[model samples]
Target: MTLRSRLPELDDATMSAEQRRVLDDILSGPRGNLDGPFLAWVHSPQLADHAQRLGAFCRYHTSLPLRLTELAILTTAAWWKSQAEWQIHAPIALKAGLSESVVEALREGRQPTFERSDEVIVHRLASVLYQHRRVDQATYDRAVEAFGEEAVVELVGVLGYYALVAMTLNVFEVRRGDEPLPFDEP
Candidate 1:
């Protein structure tokens, strides 16, 4: 679908070349998609900042390995039913080391029963932070102690960003490719 038809909700047409390239890539749908609404929203100035900050935060913060970080991100997306996020990230998450079973549980909106102790800790820890905005003393102390203060701060920051992104995707009714994710795909 052309950008005009698929996303009539879009009120603007002036896309930066960089933005246009990204949009075209998303639309091409080779890997998966976040086809229309999300593309449209990110074209906006405000959401663009949020998107950029998230990328930087993910790379620089979080002592939870990229694998664990992706798991946290995927679980947040799934919990919020943010298809745009899940679309863009599921394959990336798999590549980063989230297993099929954990992805499925996340996609199905359940607390994933992760096999690894560290995965379980991150999942449970992230869940509490997102759901409550505060962690209990022990969990907080443990994570901060395990990851150190800076890393823990970064983890919370990264998770917070994704949580906000999920909210936007849901609010704007973003649609990726028509098909749901093959969470089990290798």
Candidate 2:
């Protein structure tokens, strides 16, 4: 199904000063362009500002390795069935060394067999949290054991930030174009 965005991008001429400022920040920041939920978020400039900062930290400064970080983000995207998030991150995940089989399994909603112990830990942490809304003690311990407590904290932050992104994309029906959606919509 094709879903139209509930909030269209604001024309620069119509933007309030705050919105323009946030837009400039987004354009100049690490992301370098507006896409996905940012298009919807610009409607609330303060929210766009704060959320973008948190996102930049979660996506860039987290202690987790790039591969593990992308794994966590993809896990969140799959759980949320967010096409926008999936499209943006799946290639990054593969380029960071996550196997194609793993990405395909995630897209297909299957348990992927991970060769790396760290991948297993990251996937388990995300899956348990999504399923139970909390990680089991064993899962938490495995995560902390694989990555330090600080990294574990950052992993959760990545998940939380992406979950917010997923909600925004889903609620606002954001999309790139008429391309097919990655996940089936009921």
Candidate 2 ranges with C-alpha deviation above 4 Å:
1-4
lDDT tens digits by residue: candidate 2, 74-135: 89889999988898899899999999999999999999999999999999999999999989
Tens-place lDDT digits, model 1, residues 21-118: 55455445432344424455546646654465455557445566888788878877776777667876788889888898888888877767777777
Total colliding residue pairs, candidate 1: 0
Candidate 1 positional error at 181, Å: 6.5
Whole-model alpha-carbon lDDT for candidate 1: 0.66
For model 2, what is the C-alpha lDDT against the true structure?
A: 0.90
Top lDDT prediction, candidate number: 2
TM-score of each: 0.72, 0.96
For model 1, name the residue pairs that clash.
none
Q: Which is the leading candidate under TM-score?
A: 2
The clash numbers for all candidates, in the given order, read 0, 0
